[model samples]
Target: MRIGTMLGDVLRSLFSRTATRQYPVERAQPPTQLRGKLYYDPEQCTGCSLCVEDCPAYAIELITIDKTKKQFALRYHVDRCTFCGQCVESCRFKCIQLASNEWELASLDKAAFTNLYQRAENDASNVEKVAATDVETPDKE
Candidate 1:
């Protein structure tokens, strides 16, 4: 390459506008159809394990707290999820969905990857105990 041509190219690049967006500070709106983090509503859920069964990555678990009251808890493994929207598709009661705005799920804590969702009126202590025991973290060894 000639020095004049190289200098011209460098000058052109320096004068041109930046191609990349400032990701964290200036965010772009996610599309409506974009599949993101999985959300579960226990109130609408019928305690059916269809979402659990439909998940190819086995990321969702539906646990029954009380059969009579239809109380349930959803254990979601975010790290294991593939964002395939299978759980959302399988749910007949419209209890599960993939939030378009919740795509940024990166976390340093392993416990953050495991989410336990239960009704507010349900026993918090019981749910906490269950979460404590059920949450599986990798050995740091």
Candidate 2:
């Protein structure tokens, strides 16, 4: 509160380093296992809905085409995701994964965060159907 003490404090403030960073010039590297954007490899997925079933936040939804192949039509709506990595961990096939990509999430509408992923071939479902049938055996009494 004294005038002389205030003047001394003001002098020290001018020489101190800034708390803010120079951002663009000094980019920050994300840590290992940093949860950023979610990425799905269509070829790796089986449309089993295991990731959807394990998601704690219910952020994942599985949409499939009802052909003989039972192909996955879409995998969308990740905006409500909490980045808990539960879906990633639950994927037995290593189909679900998160990309290191970050910083494009901002948008005026909430819909902007929703990402869409679609599968090309339907071989996964066919494999499932074959596996299901292979487990059965005729009973001989």
Candidate 3:
């Protein structure tokens, strides 16, 4: 009986394909609904910061612009990200999205794991510093 089982195993090994993927050499595509990385579209973003507040992982930060836009000028962080999709669900503007970047996440440096989320303006222009006009002025002497 043992000899027959060993023969069957040998034949199975010869005919069956390998189960593991080659990783970097051959990566599997993530499913359409799989939440991999979160991306933010600045133009579509309302700067409501709802995504920030809704983040259970506290991975998101919102830096606001002082102008009338009332929207976040720069927003990004990946330090403690749990990859939870709560933030995306909270966004009413549909600015947040789950990106397909599944395999490139590993990094020797801890900071590399962080997914930087930025708005469209942040990509084209530097973050503008708030001017003194926005600050409360002291009473006249």
Q: Which number leads on TM-score?
A: 1
Q: In model 3, where do residues sit more than 4 Å from their true spots? A: 1-4, 114-141
lDDT of 2 by residue, 57-119 (tens): 667666554534644533445577788888789888787777665735667887666665655
Where in model 1 is the C-alpha error above 4 Å? 128-141
Query: Deviation in angstroms for 30 in model 1?
Result: 1.2
Residue-level lDDT tens digits of model 1 in 57-101 = 878766777768877888898999999988888889999889999
Better-scoring candidate (lDDT), 1 or 2: 1
Query: What's the lDDT for residue 46 in model 1?
Result: 86
Which wins on lDDT, candidate 1 or candidate 3? 1
Q: Regarding lDDT, does 2 or 3 come out ahead?
A: 2
* Deviation of model 2 at 137, angstroms: 32
Clashing pairs in 2: none
Tell me the whole-model lDDT of each prediction, alpha carbons only.
0.81, 0.64, 0.62
Q: Tell me model 3's lDDT, rounded to 2 decimals.
A: 0.62
Any idea how many clashes model 2 has?
0
Give per-model CA RMSD.
4.9, 9.5, 7.5
Candidate with more favorable, higher TM-score: 1 or 3: 1
Candidate 3 lowest-lDDT run of ten: 131-140
